[model samples]
Target: MAINTPPIAFGTDAPSSARGKQAGKARRPVPAPRPGLVTAAAAVVGVGLGATLALTITSETSSEFTGPGGVASFAGNLTGMAGSYLALVMVLLVSRIPFVEHVLGLDGLLRWHRRVAPWPISLLVAHAVLITIGYAQTAKTGTWHEVGTLLTRYPDMITAAVGLGLMCLAGVISIRAIRSRLRRETWWTVHLVMYLALAISFAHIIVLGPSFVGHPATQVVWSVAWAASAGLVLCYRVGLPVVRSIRHGLRVVEVRPEGPGVVSIVCSGRNLNRLAVSGGQFFCWRFLTRSHWWQAHPYSLSALPQPPYLRLTVKSVGDHSASLALLRPGTRVAVEGPYGTFTRHAQRHRRALLIAGGIGVTATRALLEDLPRAAQPVVLLRGTRQEDLVLREEVANLVRRRGGKLHELTGTREQQGLDEQSLPALVPDLLDRDIFVCGPEGFVADIVATARALGVPDEVIHYEAFAL
Candidate 1:
């Protein structure tokens, strides 16, 4: 899509008073702590780190170290303990609990989950290697021989090895290059395998882990942490969505084309308002048809939920999404969300600049209908051609009726690409406005970096990438 930033009159140097007046009008009241999602997330990480530290201190002081072998054993034990703690954190992050989603937003939580994921795997790998060497040292056997014996003769090591294999496989598939090459269904299946890996590894920890053996209190704490993490996953990720889907009886009622290859699928259900969805949020939708029922895809709401109805606009970008065009009315649908923070709730200023690239307009269009009325928001829809602009006329009408601005940029990327001066020229008081951006991953990244360079604070620049 065209990515140019038009040089508007506002960008030109104006009277100091005029600039100050506009800036004053753009200023908003201070927002709540939760809007600072990154900081709130850092607090969660800090708490997790603190817990790991306490466990290490308690275990280290309680035990005695005799020699090199003892030191290796202690190191292995520490890695295992940290790995377990991080694994629990990873589960809680992807649980989809309302409290967690409300506080961190799905995008934020997923980002954190990705960051914390490698720690557990890396630590577990270290644990496996170090523990093997420690045991080999004690038994005076070759390391390879010790590993073989540990796997074949130990109580739970065989099963743990299987779990380790699964984890390693999942890790390999999760790399960006490999993951990008896979379909969403394939990627999701690999992640689901992680749950089994964790379950299978649990016995090995309790039965053979040095930190758990002969340490009743520590074992109880670890058990309780694992139990709580599992409970959250069961209650929120599994039970709640199932119950909600049953209660609402959501089904696809219509599918209408928007622009080019884009289609808007409308779902009808009972008490949709109860979902408490915000504009700019998305749902992980599963259309229960022969070909599509096995996977759920995240789609942003294209309009405000009006009782019994929710609308999602999808572009035919992949095999799963392309199948949406063939979906008939009456298809049963399961939804899991109202997830994300690219909404009015994240606005920190009186005036807003909503920028969308290509299909990303689905989110910004939804936000147009519900952003605080006083913000007098302006929307910039960027696309390569008129046909590439999904929901342009509709959003333009909304902006006009709401007394806001809508700018349509249509041309090749070379023609419309934004420059350093272009953004500030288009919106003179951009520094004082809450900026929301949505688009392809690369496009969104470029815009965000430009906004940051132009002085938008990280917190005030709300964004969600449509590509996951």
Candidate 2:
């Protein structure tokens, strides 16, 4: 009779977020916790609401209720004022500030920003509708006539109307059905107009809103908050990039084809290691050439950063991406990252699974070399065809040197299914390992679902999607 070795189960039945301990190995501490940035954000909203409520109550007690019109006016003022603050929050979230990004991660912050986006516009709409009706009732006039009067007769109202119009236009363009029809650059430019809309609308609030009347403290608070939000945007989104570009003097060094429609761009910069970026992180890169200088696209660092050098692998997904292959050597570059939590810091288990589909392999391949020696990760590359595999040889070499496994799944899901059961079958003890998934949205979603079905804990599964 031949002796048989027992099949290794990845981990015990502990929650994925929990630290796993081997029989003899001492457990390591989890990543340092950021000081409750989300909690702090929620608290700010709470405080704003409390103050708004106090102001409303004070005004209500001091005057007699004048019926539906009065109620409409009150609600309009309340919602409008609240909406302004919420818009400021949205601005702060997307400001690309390091502190907030560190705490919330780019993905978490963007998701929160999206969730809060419609609320401000919704509140603004309610403000306009209710205020129009209230004013119409008070003036004993039709709503349209009253609207015309407010636009023409009221102080700062005309500018506010224009601002509101711009806001409404942006909102309409942002609608998923409408937005998908427009180019990304077109959509981005229209979205930029919202800052002007917000600025112009603020004047109407300060000059006309009764809540700010005789309340110098409240006025100062609002002014400071708006100024701070704008300052962050100007500094991080504009000033810092220009400063970094000038200081680093990044220039294109090489552009090589990885596969059909895929290109690898290598750039050399001054003191690149000073950036303190990790392998799997990404930067919003802008190449300074006539046609391409105006728009920036976020591309992940496909290789580990070395002093004076960085590499980005891009698949032709848009006009900007397709133009990358044409980039000439020495073309100046500006960057605004390495912004994300997709790096080794996200890994929780020593045994890991790195999964990628198509162009997403860029990040995973970098991680294959970057993950700690103790991680012992398995890399799964998925593609429609063998030629679709980007960096195939490089990934295999990395896996070979790292003493890991590389499993390639080519062809359609119909031709080669990798459902919940098949995935576990391919990677034994899959439930015990931390899983990193990157791919097209639908493909990534199916993998995530499979991981969950295999009882993989949420904390051990890390993934980030680029929104640009």
In model 2, the clashing pairs are none
> Tens digit of lDDT per residue, candidate 2, span 1-468?
111131121111111232222222222222433647657866977887787667755755324347647777887888887787778878887888776676567777878877888888888888888889887876778999988898888889988888888988888898889999998889989988889999999988887777787778878888998999899999988998888888778888778777889988877777554456654677889999999888888888887654455678899987788989888877899988767777787777888899998898888877666687677778899998998898888888777767889999899888766787678888897877889888677778878888888788888888755553
Candidate 1 residue-wise lDDT at 282: 88
Which model scores highest in TM-score? 2
Model 1 TM-score on a 0 to 1 scale: 0.88
lDDT score of residue 239 within candidate 2: 94
Task: Please provide, for model 1 over 179-259, each residue's C-alpha lDDT reduced to its tens digit, 9 standing for 90 to 100.
Answer: 989976788888788889999999889877655679788778778878888998999877877988898899877777778
Worst 10 residues of 1 by lDDT: 6-15
lDDT of each: 0.78, 0.77
What is the alpha-carbon lDDT of model 1 when measured against the actual structure?
0.78
What's the lDDT for residue 241 in model 1? 76
**Model 2 CA lDDT for position 282:** 79
Give RMSD (Å) of candidate 2 vs. truth: 9.5
Top candidate when judged by lDDT against the true structure: 1
TM-scores vs. true structure, each candidate: 0.88, 0.89
